[model samples]
Target: MTLNKDHIGGLIFLTIAVVYGYFAHDIRMFPGDQFEPFNAQTLPIALAWAGGLISLVMLATAGRSAEPKPTLVNLDFMLVGKLMVLVWLFAQALSWIGFLAATILFLLVGYWLLGERRIRTLLLASIPFAVGFWLLLAKVLDIYLAPGKLWQLVLGA
Candidate 1:
């Protein structure tokens, strides 16, 4: 059978879903939290299942599609690679810098990598969004996020 965009997309989606599910299964739970209706691992595991199901359905129904085969000639693979590296760095930064600082740096650098150069525009775009998201996760959701290793060492937080 000839592969089309749908088939490729489905395969990629399936791979991501499976990987996500695998990690979700490893999530640690607090004592007695497993018996609760929802816990730390609940949403991730549920999303993984949903993603897997959707991807499987996508693959099953991807027998044929009108969409043209994706072209690689114009693809900016260097940018993609940079973005991937950025993501890795962000993960590393999370442990060292803490959630808020790491997030702020990630968003700012991500915007810059995507070609946003204006100083005001970059700050305007990244800062508020990062702060707001941090607030949402820490305040609204009451999720405890560490401030960062830098802050702890410098400010003795």
Candidate 2:
């Protein structure tokens, strides 16, 4: 039997699902919490089973039809490398620049890298997203966010 892309993808997804299910099943519940309605492992195990079932359906349907094979294209390594670097820089800047500023900058740079040339649109989209996320996590949720080293230095806070 010839292995098609769908078959290969299904096998890979199946493997991942099995691994996820195994880990999820092995998660230890707290003492006297065995009868609880929900636990940490519940959702993960359910998702793993769902993924496994979907994978089985995919594998079973593979090569059943005479569909044309899709053409493959060469990957752009330079673009991939740039995205990797961008992610690394974003991680590094997260603490130093704080969540709000760093997220806005990251989104702006990401949009630019993905061929967004309009400054007004970029700012309009990114600023609100960053500010909203900050407000949601920090203000509404009462989660602590780093004030940023730069802000601390500038404001002496």
Candidate 3:
């Protein structure tokens, strides 16, 4: 049997899911801290299980197709590289600019890079998302997010 992309991708996905699930399962929770129904490990574990199941289905159906394999020439390596660089920059900026500011910048730049040229739309989308997510984490979830070193220095807070 010929090994197709699906087979390889399925195996990789399944392996990642298993590893992620394993690590997620090892998360430690504080004693008597049961305010929330879901803990830190909940989302990761759920996503890992979902990914593993989908990967298993892909692996099972991979050998049933006899169609001609598609070439990789259509894949845009430059776009992928740009996205990778953006992700790295976002990670670095998170500590420097904090979550809300970094996320807003990331979303704006990411949308622009992906061909969304409307400034109004970008502002409408990114600002609400950044603020909503910040509120969700900080207010609703009672999580503490850094207000950024730059903001701290500038505002003298």
Candidate 4:
């Protein structure tokens, strides 16, 4: 009846791993003979096992630590709430705007939300990170990322 934070957290983690592991296992990663020696399934299986191990560690540590019982305060709800909302916004924006522009907007907004006040820091960091990621994905990886209409016009595309 009385579930401690450790028990609850471990339960949540275990549940996630079980659900994810099921889906990961269900995917037919590669054909039989043609499969690479280390196929896609290996990574998912490793992740599932690692997640389980981490959950076990969390359970053990929570039980042994003398720290006071966990409460809502221990979870840092405000920061978590902001992070979740930011992720949601980023996902929605990613489709309409290209990856680079959306990501740059995301970084600026996230920095502002996190109470970063320096304009120089925001501009300097956002520009390079956004441009570098785009260059790496587009040029180095031989991948094409969607450039929003605005960017196309700006870059003469």
Candidate 5:
């Protein structure tokens, strides 16, 4: 079978997903049950395995598909650079800006950089994403993301 861009891309993604799952599976579990019938780490482990399995299926399906011409690996330097800078900023500000505010800032910056137009659209899209992401990490995950010094001093983290 001829290996095209689709097949190769799928294969790489699958491999990375499997590797991520493997590492996640190796972490030590927390002692004592915080929630009934479920430990803190259970969902993460389940998600990792599911991701790995999905990737495997994707790779298998791509391998069996019809081949197309390979496309050149052109990097979108501007987008990549912007994303990287934003990610770095997020990491640096995580301990200072709290979860919700930092998430909103990142989402807004990301949306604008990715060519999203309309102030209303950007505002609408960012709100849910920031709130949902914060809720997921803080509540469902039962993990405390750094609420930042400002939040800590104000809200008492």
Candidate 6:
């Protein structure tokens, strides 16, 4: 059996799932949350198990694939590095510019990095999606999101 992309991906996914499951047990809960049916670790552990199962299925079905293994010489390492930087910048921007603003910037920069140059497309794609997701997390889920240092300084909110 050759080690194709599917094999490598399945192996990586399985390894990460196992590691995540191992760490999920360490998630802390509230004083009385331990006795509940679902707690801090429940969803994580469930996702780990589901990922592990899916990875196993992928591994099993990967053996019969007809495609030959391709070399990685054509891989876009520079794009990957840029994306990594973008994610790091987004994390840093979250505290400085707030979730909605940071998310819009992240999507805009990501789309630009992927060779999209149209400003209208960038704004249309990023703004509405970021605002929708922000509303979902903030309004629908009732999660507490910081207004960011810049917003707080400017608006005093």
What TM-score does each of the candidates earn? 0.54, 0.53, 0.55, 0.53, 0.47, 0.54
Give the alpha carbon lDDT tens digit for every residue of 1-157 in model 4: 3467787788799888878888878777545823666776778877988998898888777766555556675677888799889999888777667898899999998898888989999999898999998899999998977766666667878
**Predicted candidate 2 versus true structure: per-residue lDDT over 72-91, tens digit per residue:** 57877777788889999988
lDDT of 6 by residue, 86-147 (tens): 99999999999999999999999999999999999999999999999999999999999998
Clashing pairs in 6: none
**When superposed on Cα atoms, how far off is each prediction in RMSD?**
8.8, 6.3, 9.3, 7.2, 10.5, 7.9
Return the TM-score for candidate 3, rounded to 2 decimals. 0.55
Best candidate according to TM-score? 3
In candidate 4, stretches whose alpha carbon ends up further than 4 angstroms from where it belongs are 1-3, 6-68, 148-157
**Residue lDDT tens for model 5, 19-114:** 766776676656555444776557766777776777667667876667665755696877898899999998877789877898898888899999
lDDT of each: 0.90, 0.88, 0.89, 0.81, 0.79, 0.94
The true-versus-predicted C-alpha distance at residue 103 of model 3, in Å, is 0.6
Q: Give model 5's TM-score versus the native structure.
A: 0.47
Residue 136's lDDT within candidate 5 is 92
* Global Cα lDDT for candidate 5: 0.79
